[model samples]
Target: MGALVTLELPDDSPIHDLPWIITFGPLGDDDEWEPVVCGPYERPHALALAESVVADEDLMAVVEPLLPRLSADEIRGEIAASRIAAEDDAVQTEDADIYGDYEDLLDDEPGPETVQQHAEARPAPSPEELRAGMARIADKLGNLSG
Candidate 1:
């Protein structure tokens, strides 16, 4: 069973009124967990929501058993793997600068312009769909608890 923890924030934009960052994790396999992000949100808000999800009684009940099996090194490795890599951008920029006037070199031959076809926008999920998804998550947690 997979666990989900979401952080949501309100926005004025009609396309995305409530943006969200969802952590779908604690999967039944060894795959690394990553957040499903949409719209715009602050880092602090995401952290707060994750903390709240961790503190939830039912979630904790489902997660507690898994905690004991994890070693400190494993936990650190997960953190390192999941963390964002802003540091790499600096290294990439430095490497590009190694070839003096590299930016000018690329301008010599501009690639052909490609036309992108935009897909038609779809409507948001119905309330029933949202409820069903939540119910499914609850069921997974319940099953794990037993």
Candidate 2:
């Protein structure tokens, strides 16, 4: 975790944290040659993570697991997948229909209060749905629009 700072409007002028912030972390004791979190070098387990990031595997000795035994529900992985999905902005045939349906049913709802409440009441995806969606989304959305 990080510390929390609270500010009151009564302050003369509250400047945001310069909008952009760059943070650096010190390396660990045993990690002298390696920057586990980040650095100029690629990840220590680059060969292993190649499964997730690399295009070809034969170049490497063998395909390796990036981070075995991951919880699968970790927020960090979710965030990364979300970013990748965004970069793959291509759309699927069904996606437009899905978006239109969502907009019509929710965005164009009859009442503001009703739509707001429905938004809050929406349920999280079930584990099965999560796994299925992840499998499909991990494909780089190659089937989506160009």
Candidate 3:
């Protein structure tokens, strides 16, 4: 199975509309390298802009506004749960008050109801959901331009 890759990056401004070539890692002698022009590349221009953004700083600031809206969906898909442990911890801390409320409720009754309800109520979405959400967000973002 192929791994999924996501890069939420800034646009290639000041260099926008410029053509580029896409290539994979080292190719064998028998295998010819595939090079596609900017318009025909499988991925969108935003991704190329993003990749170029990582390699170049001047383009980063131009796409700042688009980053936040796409970050969550991409984070969910590309970042492993283990990799985001600290962020998860921070998120838990942000919801500490709710946790405290649950603690208070549990303190009143050391029973299974609280655990069961919480487990059943809380939902962890599948990867496909994340992909769809990200695609939707990307489409919305792509639409904003003229």
| 1-146 per-residue lDDT for model 2 (tens digits) | 22111223233433321111121222233322311221112222332343333233212222212222234456567789988887667455366555454544544545435333335544556767876765675454455536
- Residues 1-146 of candidate 3 have per-residue lDDT tens digits of 11113435357653333322333222234434442222222245545554663453212211222222234555675567656887888788878755454555444645455433334444556667766986796687578765
Model 1, span 1-146: residue lDDT tens: 22443324355534232223434344444443443333123344444555566564223112111121134465567677656454676678778887565565454776679899999856655657766865785577568747
Q: After superposition, how far is residue 57 of candidate 3 from its true place, in Å?
A: 16
- Pick the winner on TM-score between candidates 2 and 3: 3
User: At residue 53, what lDDT does model 3 achieve?
Assistant: 39
What TM-score quantifies how close candidate 3 is to the native fold? Answer: 0.22
Return the TM-score for each candidate structure: 0.22, 0.20, 0.22
How do the candidates rank by TM-score, highest first?
A: 3, 1, 2
The lDDT for every candidate, in the order shown, is 0.46, 0.37, 0.44
Clashes of 2: 0
| Model 1 regions lying over 4 Å from their true place | 1-119
In the predicted model 3, the residue pairs found to clash are none
Off by over 4 Å in 2: 1-119, 141-146
